[model samples]
Target: MSAMTSAAPPAGARRGYPLIAAAPPLIAAVVTAAVSAAVWSRLPDRVATHVGGTGEPDGFAHPAVLVTVSVLLLAGWGAGGAWLAGTARVPARALYCGALAPAVLLGYLSPALLLANAAADQAADVRFPMWHLAVAAGAALAAAALALVLPTRPAPEGERGDGAAPRTSTLGLRPGERVVWQRTVHSWLLTALQGAMVIAAVLIAAVGGDTGAWIVLLGGAVILALTTRVRVSAGEFGLALRPALLGVPRLGVPLDRIAAAEVRPTSPLKDLGGWGYRITAGRRGFAVRSGDGLWLELTDGKQYVVVVDDARTAAALLNDLIARRSAHSEG
Candidate 1:
């Protein structure tokens, strides 16, 4: 096992996380239901439910059916958020903002759907205004902004002062010798989230006949591609991380650019905010799960971190390689 999974996070690391994350979607569902009720009389017998690429209604359903589906979807989304919160693996604020942004976007769309149908003589005549998409995007942005400003618990504190110093001469590489260290890191939380997306996609397909199901499946695929596992490689080339599922989307820090490398304990949620290819303030890196991570102090005045098993060896190897490169540059 990697050092990344050796230790558990602090108790109550996830306290109040579920409620805060789930609130937005549940509230959005209620608001959407209220709007549907207010315009119930104005809505045509058949309401425009789905639109095509042309921004025109391509599918219709009874108002009751439409509202029921919308409410159910929102409820399910909220449930998923709550479920993710229980893992205690991601930052609370991240979950809150993520939930709010999507809830607000969908909320705007639901009402726009009703208003568009209400103004039409019949469902077939309803024109799904393209501008409504812009409004939804703006509303989502506003909701995300609100999430940032709203009072919330501070990030969980990490165990500090456990950092290991760079072993610059540990390896003592021989002339013409080549050395490399590699490890693969995985995240159970990410795997579970992808599984949930797959299940949700199946449920949506069963009810909605593959209309919105593909989008959910696509999202799952994206998560799988990016967060399934990461391959960490340290050699004369310095440090590199590549998604196990894809070849092109990779990160690398050249040997010349890295000033030093060491091992340090980290909190994925607290330190880096959340996992999987993150950039925050002065430091940036991939953190699938966290414990002892390889911390790099770059020449450009920035830091990089990646959680991996046996990070000491990787760091030591990187430090040794950096020393060798520096010595060769001077000689």
Candidate 2:
């Protein structure tokens, strides 16, 4: 990826939100309150609030309590949306949908709750309305459409730029020289954390008989196994990043696509926005930890950065390879 000499703009500079992007959640909150008020009287004192897999009411709660819960949930969602809109990484469209999703859910589910509880005197008479599901789905689609049409903030200035001039090769490769530099990186802390999570998931699935929990644990295990060790190499062919076990390259930057290479210090969370395989509009990164790394700028204006030890040697080798390729092309 292209590197920036200057630091990022202050968080305060990125805090504004577009009116269209901010309106949906507010509108949804108001509609939820209005609908709740309108149906407050028709709802029973205690409604069949939760249904089991067999389509029977398994739990009951007062309608007022449910409305209160919905209101609280909407409030929490609104606050979260406001916070998310201020962040640079998250897309406005995603924020809009996420913010309004709770309201849309409660809007249809509230009425459905009343319908399900209408014949509370006869428990067997209750049936969920498929129309309510359709209505909720339609509302969600409309919100998503609005989010798509809303204008988004421009990408930040200095997000990408030609980095500093290349340092001389540490490998001392002369013009037309070809050599390879390779290294493997691993993060013990991350691996341990993931392992702990997998164990917890396994235990929960065993005790609770949750097939979904078992699936989640298995997926985590697979990811942990794949990501524990990464193999990175730089040669005349360019740079390749792959999992050690898989041996198949997941990312490759050809000699021609690479404009420059540099070794630079980085913050995993602050710079790359947290660990492995991060993709944004302008750049992609494979960041395992906070430290120095080899950064590459491609001809197409995108960047790829990977955090690893021995970055100085790797950057030098990559630069030499790119220079050799360029000289050969000129001849």
Candidate 3:
């Protein structure tokens, strides 16, 4: 196939693309970290425990601890968000939520943990676990809200692709076209698994009448809802996924928003908090629904990932896109 060249960005606006694009993840990370830090620092000096007298007071900021933990949390959230923006075969919503979840968790949990520890001398109270639950609830609500906020960049003047809204015709997947198919299949598989989980969860809720089962069901529902929307489009745009309760979700992206693309098998367990759209540079990247796939590094410093049916094929397609884009730009 002939490599095509990309047209240059319009005068005065070229430089802005990089900056604008980078803002999403960077902002998400910074904001999340700040919020988390603020929450962490608010624990009660002496939390009562079941053991006995309350232990020594706890301070949220140990300066060093605050910086270290905040940095770590920020990095995790940023990587996760960018990864989703770049690859996930879905929309930025999922990734945004992904980032927000950890931030909220860190904010509330870290502090709560300290409080729990502080109160430990008094007794083996439920402070720690209860705090964890509180953190989880708050995070869930916050994530839900933020994920719905949606990240959007201007679609280039003449740009369009699979990630675009919708069409009257087929998805435009043509034979012999330079494209990635594995990710689609993998995403579909994940969708199927999520569907099964949701079904099992529903069954458990119905047959078992257990709140735990209901909670599990809800989780599966979230996954199922997330999995179905991932996809690559006829347009040259990269993978995108939009979550449920979010609009007419689909696997989509704006062609111009893409910054970079690459391929690498991840230490699913070690690098990411364990697969399913993991993100972090040193230890993370967006990965959705498991397995090896393609990695897209957006100008936003976020890694959007797609689980490819064939990694080799996905790499070839990405190389083609980069070449085409570069060529088009230089033309």
Candidate closest to the true structure, highest TM-score: 1
- How close is every model to the real structure, measured as TM-score? 0.54, 0.48, 0.34
The parts of candidate 2 lying over 4 Å away from their true place are 1-170, 174-177, 205-208
Candidate 2, 200: how far from true, in Å? 2.0
Q: Write the per-residue lDDT of candidate 3 for residues 71-179, one digit (tens) a residue.
A: 4445534544443333323334544465556556655554455445443443233244444566668766877696677665554453333243211112233344555
Question: Deviation in angstroms for 315 in model 3?
Answer: 2.7
Q: Candidate 3: minimum summed lDDT over ten consecutive residues — where?
A: 164-173
Which portions of model 1 miss their true places by more than 4 Å? 1-158, 161-169, 207-210
Q: List the residue pairs that clash in candidate 1.
A: 2-309
Which candidate should be chosen as best, given lDDT against the real structure?
A: 1
Candidate 3 achieves a global lDDT of 0.45
lDDT (C-alpha, whole model) for all candidates: 0.74, 0.64, 0.45
Best to worst by TM-score, what's the order? 1, 2, 3
On the 0 to 100 scale, the lDDT of residue 283 in model 3 is 31
